[model samples]
Every structure is written in C-alpha cells, then in structure tokens.
Target: MTLKVERLGHSTRLQEVSFAAQPGELVGILGANGAGKSTLLQLLCGVLEPDAGQLTYQQRDLTQISAYERRQLLGYLPQTPVAEGGIRVDHFLQAGLVNLHLSCPGKELNRVVETLQIHALLERTLDKLSGGEQRRVHIARALLGDHNWLLCDEPTTSLDLYYQLQVMAVLRAQADRGKLVTLALHDLGLAARYCDRLVLIDKGRLLAEGAPAAVLTDANLAQAYKIKARWLCTDEGVTLLPSLLS
Candidate 1:
C-alpha cells in the first residue's frame, strides 16, 4: 500500500496538508522557509503527533502504530542531524543500527558505505570531517536498513553544488530501486531533475502537487516565493536559475 496523509495538521507549523507517495517515486517537498516542509516530514516519520488527520502505510495506520512498528516502517534524517563530535565514523554508523534495531550490521554498514562512497572516511572522527563528509555519514546512517519509506529534511542543504547533486542522485537512485523517498529541498533544480513528483507547500498549506513542470510554474513561483524567476528547460530536465530571481 502507498503512504497516505489525510488532512494532516500540526499546531500552526502545518495545516491540513495531504499527499500520497508510492514506492519507486522520489517526492520533493518544496517551500519557503517555515513553509511547513520540515513539519510535514516530521509527521510522515512520526517525529510529531498530528493534531488532526490520518497517516497510513502498507495497510497499517501509522497514527496509531506502536513505536517499534513505526521504527520498522520509517527511516528519517532530521534537518540538523547531530552526533558526538568525538565519535568515530564507524561507531557513529553502527549506532544507527543499534538504535533502529537493524540486523546484520556489517552487511548493512558496507552497503551504505559503498553507496555513499564514504569507505575511506570510516576511521575518522565526526569533528574531523568536513561538512559534506559529515552529511554523507548522516545520510548513510538514515539509510542503514532497507526501508521502503524514507524521509529527510533538506538533505542537500549547506553543501557545495557537487555534493548537492551527488546526494540527490543517490536518493533518486534509491527511489528508482523501489523506495518511497521524500526530502525537503530548497534547490528547485535538484528537485526538478531528481524528484518524480513535487509537493509545493506555502504558508503551511498545499499549494500544488504534481509533476515538476506542473508544480514549478511561473504562477506557483510568484505565489509561493513572491519572486520572478526563470526556468531553463531542456531535453534532460528543468533547472531554476537563481540569477534570474528578482
């Protein structure tokens, strides 16, 4: 069964936002700062209890599910992931397995390390790594298990463009391999190119939800961001030019 949200609300941060995502689709949550993208993701991963509405996945009602069951169903990466600065990368990743109660730590660890290309950094401590490297490790931790549903808040934030595309590509590949991956991303270009569908949130409400070309239109940009922007469209995909922001 697909992941479904019906009239979901959380205080004033989010209100009556509803959407559905299926396995094999990468969904991007697009919104301005404080537009409830992060809040919506929290409800998806059970970080916050909804003050209203329903959340269900795989024929199970997530709103009423046990913590253990929720753990089994969702894997999450917070907007600002934290770890002991002194902890070694290996141990840090291993801890995620322990926390999530995952099996075959060695196998799982190797898989994520390989996918994220972080094998060489395994012996380094968290404080020693650069921002991009730390973000990669955090993503690896969130991806420890074979979760069908994954939620991440701004997985590409604060990284250089290279890392941004790398991380988004990894998540997109995961979705192609049959996982419902959702992430809140500020980069419209990344979201347009990598996400199978987009949910445009504005002022804690759903402004639009559809294909990239449909959601990232001139009208939506003006309404959601209050800016005049340009889209460079090509055979490959759409790319939003920040220079055109006015």
Candidate 2:
C-alpha cells in the first residue's frame, strides 16, 4: 500500500507539501520546531483535513473512505496521546482493538506487549505510570491492530536512551514486515540510523526527500535546521553530528 499526499496544506501551519510512503519503508519526517512536521502527520492520519490538496491511499482518495473504514487501515499515535487517568494499561491497549470491532489474535497482542516490555504495567492505571511507561503503553496500543500504515508523532519523547532504541527497533521491525511506518522526530542521529527515507521540511514546505544520506546533507541541514553538521558512515551505521549552530 502507498499513501500519496498531493500539495497538501493546512491553514497557515503548512503550505503545499507533497510526499508519499510505500509499504516496507520507514519514512522519517525531520524538521525544526514548528516546521510543519506534526501538521503533516496530522493531515496524513486524517486528524486534520487539508484546505487545498488531496490525500490518496492505494490510489483511492482518502476523503472517499468512511471514517470508520479509514481507521481500520491507519493507526496513529499523536505526540501527546490522551489516556484517561482511570484506565488501566491493558484496558487501554485492548480498547484500540475493541473500538474498531477488530480481533487481533492473542499471540499478536502478546508479541506487541512483550516487545514494548509493558507486560508488568498491564494492571497499572495510566495515572500511576511514568511518562516513558505511558508512552510505551500508548505505542503498544497503536501497534495492536496491524494496520497498513502507522503514523507516530515524536513517539520517542519521554523515553530514555534504552527505551528509545528499543522503540526504534520495534518500529524498524514493523517496516521490515512490510508495514508503512512514518514518524515525526527531532533526533537526526536516530532517524539516520533507522529510517529508510527522510523527508525534510522547513517553513511549511518540503525541502528534500530521498535516502537518508542524500536528503540529510550539510546544505540541507543548514537550510532547514540552520546548523553545521557532519555525517559519519561507519561499519555499524550512519551518524549525524551537529557541530555548531549556524
């Protein structure tokens, strides 16, 4: 499956921005603060409608899909996922599947729960968990439905170094399994290491889109982020180090 955004715009927050994500690809949306990264994700997930463009999934216009039908194919984890303080972690996760009247195999749910390391927190209420724990719980909830496309906004926020890596690994594994995963991220190094494609935006416009190495050039970073950076490729992987403020 593929998601195509043609000249999508959202009021003053985003201009005419277009991009696409295909199955089996991990697309990272990278930009500075207020650079339309979150806006783009919101538009893609149908949280906000574009004022002046079209969004298509597998050649069908997204607007033509019923809200309930759309939700079945797309899973979204907003930057600040709201969880009722009263709901337990397990209940919250199960609600994701239940709301759609979808049945995820018990083993599939168990796999996501175990991958996120949230097995112990299942009984705890959302109000009782730490920020990172809650983030993991919400992430596990998003992964429950096996949707064709997953759009996550700053999912690594509040996560520590270890959990952040673990979360990225899980997302990468999802992409490897042929799911389209798109996320808004501020960490260039993490995006470089895990994402198959990078979409760089600035001032409400798309600046670059391609392989990480090509799209994350010094010129592009300087233009989009206003920073001097160096790219290092090692046996392990790619690393983008910001040298100095531009």
Candidate 3:
C-alpha cells in the first residue's frame, strides 16, 4: 500500500503539504511542537478530511471511498489514546479484532499479547495499567487487524527506554512484513535507528523527505529546529549527536 498526499490542508494549521510512502516502508515525521504532525496522521486515518488536494491510496482517491472501507485498510494510533469503558485489556483487544472482522483466533491473539509483553495484564482493567502499559495495549489493538497502513503519532511517548526500543522494534518488524508504517516521533535517534524514511515538517510545511542520514543532517536540524546538532553514522545506524546551542 502506498499513500500520496498532495496539497493537503486543514482549517488553521497545515497547508499544501505533500509526501508519499511505499509499502514495507517505515516513514518517520520529525518536527518540533505544533508542526501539524498529528494533524497529518489524523487526515490520513480518515479521522479528519482535508479541505483541499487529494489523498490517494494505491492511486485511488480516498475521499471517494466509504468511511468504513477507508478505516478497514488503515490503523491509527493518536498522540494521546484514551481507553473507553470499564473493559479489561484482553476484552478490549478482542473487541477490536471483532470490529475489524479479522480471522485471528486465540493463538494469534496470545502471540501478539506475549510479543508486546502484556500477557500478564490481559485480565487487568484498562484503567489499572500504567500509562506506558496502556499505550502498549493501544498499539496491540491498532495492530490487531491486518491493516495495510499504520499512522502512529508519538508512539514512544511515556514509554521507558526499554519499551521505547521494543515498540520501535515491533514497528520495524511490521514494516518488514510489508506494512506501510508512518510515525510522528520526537526522538530523532530512535527514528534513525528504526525508520527507513524520514519526513521533516516545520510550521505546517514540509521541509524535507528522504533517508534519515541525509534528511537529518546537522544543517537540516539547525534549519528546521534552530538547534545545532552533529550527525554521526556507524555500522549500527545513524545518530543525531547534538552539542550545546550557543
């Protein structure tokens, strides 16, 4: 699945921004606060409609499709996910899969739960889990159905170092399996490590889009973020090493 956004616009913020992502690609959107990253994700998820331009999925206009059909092909994780009802974690996940009409049985559910390391909290109420834990459950639910596209906003927020890497690892695995995963990330280092592509936006406008190493250069960081940062590449991955701003 590939996505094309041309001249996409919101009411007050983003304007005429465009980008594209191919299948099995992990595209990370990097920007400072209020960069319209969340808005872009919401638009792509069909939660909000663009006033102008075209959103195409596989060369088909998304606005022409039914809301239900558009949702069935996309999975979205917002910046802040609020869990509803007094449902237990496992029950919520089950309901999510049911709503998507996925064919996953008990075994698959167990595997996903275990992979996220949330098996122990399955029986717990959603409200009982920590913020990070709840975020993990939300991720598991978003990934429950076999959706082709994932639009995640700030996926690593509230997660500790361990779980942060873990979440990125899971996202990378999803991309490897031919899913188009787009994430709005604050952590540039993590983005470089896991994301196959990067889209940089500033003040509701697209600044750059390409490989992390190229798009996340010292000059680009300074230009978009107004902060001096050094770029280092190793066999492991690219690193955004920053010095004290003067």
Please report the candidate that would top lDDT against the real structure: 2
Error of 1 at 182 (Å): 0.7
lDDT of 1 by residue, 1-246 (tens): 698888999996998989888899999999999999989988888778999988888867887887777777778999988657799999998887865665677898899999888999999999999988898889888898878888999998667778787888899888989999999999898888999999999999999998988998888988888876777889977787653345
Q: TM-scores, in order shown?
A: 0.94, 0.95, 0.93
- Error of model 1, residue 119, in angstroms: 1.5
Relative to the true structure, candidate 2 reaches a TM of 0.95
lDDT, model 2:
0.88
Predicted structure 3, TM vs. truth: 0.93
Candidate 2 clash pair list? none
Local accuracy of candidate 2 as per-residue lDDT tens digits, 26-73? 999999999999999988877788898999989888877777887788
Off by over 4 Å in 3: none
Q: How does each model score on lDDT?
A: 0.87, 0.88, 0.85
